[model samples]
Target chain A: MTSILEVNNLTKTYDQFSLDRLSFSLQKGCITGFIGVNGAGKTTTIKSILGLINPEAGSIRFDGMEMNRQEKQIKNRIGFVLDEGYFYGMLTVKEMKNVIAPAYSSWDEQTFSNWIGRFGLNPNQKIASLSTGMRMKFAVALALSHHADLLIMDEPTSGLDPMMRSELMAILLDFMKEEGKSVFFSTHITSDLDKVADMLILIDGGKILLNEEKDTLLDNHARIKGDSRWINERTRPLFLTLRETPYGFEGLTHQKEALRQEMPDAVFERPTIEDIMLAYVGGAEIAH
Target chain B: MLINLVIKDFMLMKKYLLFLVLFALAAPIVIASQTKDDSLLFLMPFYLIMITEIATYLQVSKFESISRGAAFICATPYTRRTFIEAKYLFVFVTFVGILFAQIVASFLLPSLKTGLNLNAVGAAFLMVSLLFGVLIPCQIKFGFDVVRWIFFGLAFLIPFSLGPILRWYQSLGIHFSFSLPVSQTGQILLMYVFAVVITFVSMYASIKIYEKKDL
Candidate 1:
């Protein structure tokens, strides 16, 4: 399958933070959840892909075009939503459509209005007065109105309420059903990704720790909740990030399928995206 | 792509432009009424210059820290090079617009009326004001306030630095007189052409600097 967004050997550095040789790809007709904790370089990686911050060493190809060489042409095919990309405070919703629509060649006014009705947003309300959820919904609406093949959203769900998040997920899920469109959404909210993302790319401390199909990342790995004896017998010593407590110990392992038959007493549970992420990136807290 | 970027700038500017245009047009009127400092009327372009730069800030590169959170323009099909060009050229075009408006208004205002008196020195200064103040630093620094503060602060020193020049003419009793070595029409046309050329040169320089800017 052809990838829609391909990042290769990317590296960028600030005085305090660095993204080191990070590489990943998102295939068309798939949604990739860019999962990471705070300060895990998810925003930085997204910025690099958008060409907001020039990567010191790397190449990013969107729909098979070199981002630097054909930047204008490449960006034309992409849409983006930042966590705080609030619209002009003075603009009304209808005014926003008038102002921002022309910037894209394929902006469908009818589609935008349809989304507004779907989200139940008023067309005449000023942006500054809208609630946080409303603003995020508006951003999503604007992103989709433009005929962009790839959509990159950075922490788009951080401030939203649960219902609104689910609403957004449902919207994005519906969007991915379209054949050529793909989404790369970065978020700390793992639950939002749980239902929608086909793939998960996890990063911590400026490096990619895991990038795989969400089901594969979940199914191949399982959480074992049992005593140290079970862990000692069944755990893959290389991959176990075990958390020990006063009563007992429970943790995660990549080789859970391999260890399951060996220790029948240990309770091996199917993991969520959050469980696997917290286990590795939270290694110090969970490391036994 | 450049077209969309320009329109985006216009969209962002449209939000703040009302207050800016009013402030630019009225500040000198307020000064004229309060102090009757006729010289203040000549300073109207300076006010226009300030408003143009501020509009560039609000419209174009508003953020000092580059984050995915605040990045909208940096994420667009507009390249960093084209981004800076639009800002610089927009300033140039705005300056010309203001200059033309001033030329027309000078004829209409009874109290503040005077024929335009642009000479080679005045023309060069306009170029310097357009480039050194508005264009170069914006391209180099890439933040609105950072570039504006540095350039305006230095420009603020120009009058003070000229104290010695003012003192020399006073002390020597040797009067200085200046004139462009051309006919009135030639001078006016030359200055207009110079403004156009300088604007483009500075615009090109801004594009070059922006293309090389490290992020």
Candidate 2:
């Protein structure tokens, strides 16, 4: 499959934290979930991709065009919904739309109107007056109205209730129905990714830890539960994270078959995206 | 694209601009009535233009800072140069708009006609250009909030320090005086050229600062 967005050796630095040569790409027509803990350079990476922040080193290409060389052309094809609305609170919805619509050559007034009506957004109301969900919907409306090929969302569902998140997921799923459309969604909420993301890219400490198909990632890793006595030095190295209780020990491991051959009595279960993320991020901390 | 950005700023500042324009029109009439000074009438248009320019800048800066709209603009198809160009164009258009309003008001209220000449207009343009030439880059570098406090600090400090600063200069035992050998028209032309240079330099500086800045 063709790649929609590509980043190679993307590097950015701050005094306290730095994104250390992070690299990832989103395949065309796939929803790629970018997951990382707070302070893990998710926003920094997104900003770099959007040209909001200049990276120290990297090349980001969209549809085979370099971002820096064709920034305006590249941006015209890309739409972004940041964590915060970042809109002028004083302007009414229609007025704000007026401000943005002119910037995009392909802005569709009819589509924007349709979205406003479908979202039940009041065009006359100031953006500040809208609820978080409404603001997000408005943002989505704006992003979609421009006929953009790629949607880049950074924590679009953060602070939203479960219902809004589901709605947002539905929107993304609907958006993907069109061929050659892709989404690069960044969020810590793995459950939302579980519903829609085809590919997953997990990052920690400014580096991508894992980038693979979601199902393959889930199939490769398992939650293993067995007697605490089985967690000796030999077995400890196999588990990504292990937690012990009085009754038993539970752990996550990608080498589930290898462990099964060693300990035939161990119980294996399907691991969720959250479990995988936690296993990678939590390390091997002892839990009593 | 630059026009769109400028229009956006104008839309954001419309309410403030309306209030300022109303006050700009009425305040001169009220002050002219109270002070009964015809000379003050000539200065009134310049003062109003300056006030309108500064108020517009402050409102736009505060809105952008509070709303993170600058960061949002970075995501758009417009380049950083376009954004900076829009700002310069916006301020220039605003200055002209207020000057036009002053001219119309002068026609309506004949008493307000105080022989507003090219020299006065040139002086007003030069003053605003110098002020914004310093203010824009400072706002971009330090942010609106810090620049505001700096403005306030200078406002308070300049008056109090002027006496002491003069005394310090006297203590240095240095005296210098010079007069330019130029015609009135030549000086006016020079002032206009200086204003244009200041504006472009300020714009170049702002663009460089903003391009390197991590939003």
Candidate 3:
């Protein structure tokens, strides 16, 4: 399968935070989870890919077209749903539909209406009046209705309740059932990722820590817990990141079987996406 | 797609902009009772207030505010140059629309108790164009907040202490009166055209600068 989006060696720097040579790609017809903590350059990476932020170096290609120069061509097929709805507050949903529909050559009015009905949003409701969840749903609806082959969303499920998130996941799953549609969504909600993402790309400290199939990542990274003293070289075989506490040490590593053989006292457990993510992003404050 | 978005922006602006323009027109109608130089009284305030609001609307986006930062506009398919060009074009079009409306209003209404000067309308258009041309570049360079401060400082400082500037203008024998070598119709057309062309080029340049902006 071809990559729908490819970000190559992307770097964006600030006085305090820098995206360090970030590179990743998402294939068509898959749900890719972009996991990162706040200020971990998750939004920055998305912004860079969207051509919202001009990076200091590297390039983004969509369907093999340069993002910066061929933005119109690429954006035509890419639908983006930011965390919050970006629309005139006074505009009714109907007005938004009327206004935004013409911009996409393949925008489907019927599909848009169906999503609105599915989401139970009043088309006549002013955008300012919609709750955050409803607004997000509306954004999702718009993102999906434009006949876009690739959907790039930022924290879409962050504000959603569990039930709504489940609904959203179902919608995404149904969307993927059809051919040639892919979604790359960024979020801190690991459960959502676990539920829907086909692949997980863990990012922290302005860099990609791991990019692998969700199942493989889950299978390989095991959380081994015991006393801090148990974290010996024999157990530290090709570990990804190590987190220590006074009670015990939890090291995320793919060498679980070897470590288990080495230390019979250690308890090895399959790491959830959340556990692995926490291991990468945890600093002094979070360990508590 | 950009054109469609632009249209959307205009439609959103419709209610507020129409209200402002009508209110400006109504001012002269309400004050037709004034005994003074009704033409100057009617034209100046209408022009100034309408232009101020138009500029402010473009600056502040009275419709809705997007918190994703201005970078959002940059990330879209349209480049900064094209984006800025669109804004410049929109502002000019708005200016022309206001001018056309007022011109029509001037004819339909009872005499300003003082007749309107076609010349002042042209001058006002030039001033409005200049205002946007200068402010948009400053806005592009300094951002919305800092530019607002600079603009406010200049705005407050100029009116309070313009004696020297006024004197310098007097020294140059400059005047607003028609008696002082007003342009011929062809020259007037040329002057307006030149002003518009200059503003457009400036706007185009600003757009290019915006395209390269880090935001």
On TM-score, the leading prediction is: 2
B20-115, model 1: which lDDT tens digit per residue?
666545554455567656565555555555556555554455532332212465566555666666665555555555555555554545443422
Q: Between which residue pairs do clashes occur in model 2?
A: none
lDDT of 3 by residue, A150-231 (tens): 8888888887899889988888898888898999989988889887899889898899988999999888778777778766
Candidate 3 — which residues are off by over 4 angstroms?
A225-233, A236-251, A264-268, A282-288, B1-7, B10-15, B31-82, B110-119, B150-183
Per-candidate TM equals 0.82, 0.93, 0.85
Better of 1 and 3 by lDDT: 3
- C-alpha positional error of residue A62 in candidate 1 after TM-score superposition, expressed in Å: 1.6
Query: lDDT per residue, candidate 2, B125-152, as tens digits?
Result: 9999999899989888888899889877
Worst 10 residues of 1 chain A by lDDT: A231-240
lDDT per residue as tens, model 1, A144-229: 88778898899999988888888888888788878889999999999899899989999998999988999888888888877665
lDDT to native, each model: 0.72, 0.88, 0.73
lDDT of 1 at B19: 70
What order do you get sorting by lDDT, best first? 2, 3, 1
Could you give candidate 2's per-residue lDDT for residues A1-288 as a string of tens digits?
999899999999899989999888899999999998998889999999988898999999999999989998999999899999888998999888887888899999999999999999999999999998999999999999998999999999999999889989998999999999999999998999998999999998899999999999999999999998888877888889888889999889999888998789999999999999988887656421
CAPRI grade, predicted model 1: acceptable
Runs of candidate 1 exceeding 4 Å displacement: A94-96, A231-239, B1-70, B103-107, B110-114, B117-125, B128-142, B146-164, B169-193, B211-215
Off by over 4 Å in 2: A286-288, B34-39, B157-186
State how far residue B50 of model 3 sits from its true place (Å). Answer: 5.5
